[model samples]
Target: MRVLLVDDEHELVCALAERLGFRGVRADYAVSAEQALELARTTAYDIAVLDVKMPGMGGLELHQRLRELQPDLPAVFLTGHGSELDFAAGAARGEAYLVKPVGIEVLLETFARIAGPWDGQGGRQP
Candidate 1:
């Protein structure tokens, strides 16, 4: 499945995207909310993995905008802070939330749980 990964930490997002590619998932990344929005407008991403605390627009707001663009798109939030408040807020919004430094396996598993199984055949399984 295709993924949109957004984070202010450019290096971290790039590394994660690379790792995801190695695992047979295609990922497009953006370092800012605006960039993510632009990518979302042009790309049909199946899921979005967003960093919670970005510089201009936080993940929550970005998710709102993305949902406007693609109402059924699934999103997962990642935060280095691991704040209970943030976790609760994300949960309240019915989003999949993960702490930063998350294992790729864990992230992929979460994606499968939320977005359905990735069949390893270039698309999600029904």
Candidate 2:
């Protein structure tokens, strides 16, 4: 599925994007909320993986803004903080949450669960 990966860490974003690519998942990386918003406006991404703690616009805020643009698309929060409050917020928004340093396999599984079955016919068509 097409995924928008939003994270401030350049290395993490690049690594994740590359790993996703290797798995045949189409992933676009955005370093900031504004860039993600801009990308969302023009592209139809199936899911957004956002970092909960960002410099300017946090993941929750970004999630809200993304909903305004693409309400149907699902968003998953990739956070380092494992707090009840963060989990609650993600749950309330009908979104998934994953901790940092996640294994690529787990990340793929989480994306599959959140984005639904991939037809395997082509690249992240779903």
Candidate 3:
């Protein structure tokens, strides 16, 4: 499925995008919340993968803004920190939260579980 990956760590986001491409998943990335928002406005992504702690807007806030842009879009939060507090906060939002250094397989599985199977056309199938 088409994914919008947003993180302040440019290298990490780009690497993740490249890896996703290798798995046959189309992914676009943004290094900032503003950039993510702009891309969200312009492109139709099946889901978004956002860093919980970002420079300007955090993932939760970014998710809210993105939902405003595409109400049906799903989100997954990624963070380096794995604290109970952070986990609870993310869980409270009712979206998948994955720790950093996640395996590619786990990421792909999570995407499938959340957004369903990719339709091979940059979208998800029902």
Candidate 4:
């Protein structure tokens, strides 16, 4: 599956990208909302992993914009703050959210749950 990961934390994004790559997931990353938006426009991704608190656009706004571009795209929000407001907003948007420091197992499980199977390939159906 193709994934676009957006986060301000450069180290975290790199680490997560490496981990996802090792697991056979194609992941491209962006550190800012503008870059994420640009990437979204140019690429077809099955899932978008977005950090809730970003410099400019933030995850919620980014999610909304992304949906405008590709309504069916699934998004997962990751937040270090774990604020109730963020959680509520994410829930309202039908996005699956995870707090920072989330384990690989949890990440994988969440992705699998939201990313439905396409035949026997294990990727999302087009």
Candidate 5:
């Protein structure tokens, strides 16, 4: 499915997006929350992969705003810190989370679990 990835680290996010692409998952990434929001407005993303701690707006706030745009959109949080509070918040919100350096398989599997029938088709559901 089409995915939106947001993180403050440019290289990391770009590499992850490319890696995901190699796995046949179309992933667009943003380095900031505003950019993510703009992309969200134009793209009908099936899932969002967001960093928990960003410079301006954190992933949690971004998630809420994205939900406003696409209510059914599923999200997965990625954090390098792996703080207890972050984990708790994610759990409380029912959002699946993964620590940084996550394998592409792990991310995709999480996506499959959250959004069933992930065929790597990038939302070819029409």
Candidate 6:
């Protein structure tokens, strides 16, 4: 499966992306919402893992914009802060929320649960 990971924490995001790649998942990462938007426009990712509390256009807003770009795009929100409000916002949106320091295996499982088996194609045919 192809995934997009966006988080301001550069090391964490890169590490996660690398780990996913090592496991045979095509993963791309961005450090900002704007960069994520640009990648979203170009790539039809199977799923997106976004930082719930970003600096500017937080994950919730970014999620909406991504859906606008590609309707039905599945999103899993990641947050290290784990604020109650953040949890509520993500839950209210019908999106999956995962606390940070999450394991790679758990992430893969989440992706499978939401987006189904990879199909080995990486993305939906446009």
Best by TM-score: 1
Residue-wise C-alpha lDDT for candidate 4, range 1-126, written one tens digit per residue = 788899999999989988888776778999998888899898888889999899888988898898877788889999998788889987777558888899987887787788854332335557
lDDT of 6 by residue, 30-122 (tens): 999999999999988878899888899999899999999889888999888778887898878735899878988888888878877664345
Model 4 quality (TM-score): 0.89
Clashing pairs in 1: none
Sliding window of 10 residues with minimal summed lDDT for model 2? 117-126
List TM-score per model, in order: 0.93, 0.90, 0.93, 0.89, 0.91, 0.89
lDDT of 3 by residue, 1-126 (tens): 889999999999999999898777899999999999999989999889989999879998999999999998888999999999999988777369999898999999999898788765555675
> Per-model C-alpha lDDT, please?
0.88, 0.86, 0.89, 0.84, 0.86, 0.85
Backbone collisions counted per model: 0, 0, 0, 0, 0, 0
Q: Give the TM-score of candidate 6.
A: 0.89
Q: Which of the numbered candidates is closest to the native, going by highest lDDT?
A: 3
List pairs with backbone clashes in candidate 3: none
TM-score (C-alpha) between model 3 and the true structure: 0.93
Q: Which stretches of candidate 2 lie over 4 Å from their true place?
A: 119-126
Candidate 5 clash pair list: none
Pairs clashing within candidate 6: none
Off by over 4 Å in 3: 119-126
Instruction: Residues 1-126, candidate 1: write the lDDT tens digits.
Output: 999999999999999998898877889999999999999998898889998899989998999999999898888989888788989987766458888789989998998888778767557766
Candidate with more favorable, higher TM-score: 3 or 4: 3
* Regions more than 4 Å wrong, model 1: none
- Per-residue lDDT tens digits for candidate 2, residues 17-124, read 888887778889999999999999999888899999999999989988998999887888888988999889876774678888888888778877877767543255
**Cα RMSD to the true fold for all candidates:** 1.3, 1.8, 1.5, 2.4, 1.7, 2.6
Ranking by lDDT: 3, 1, 5, 2, 6, 4
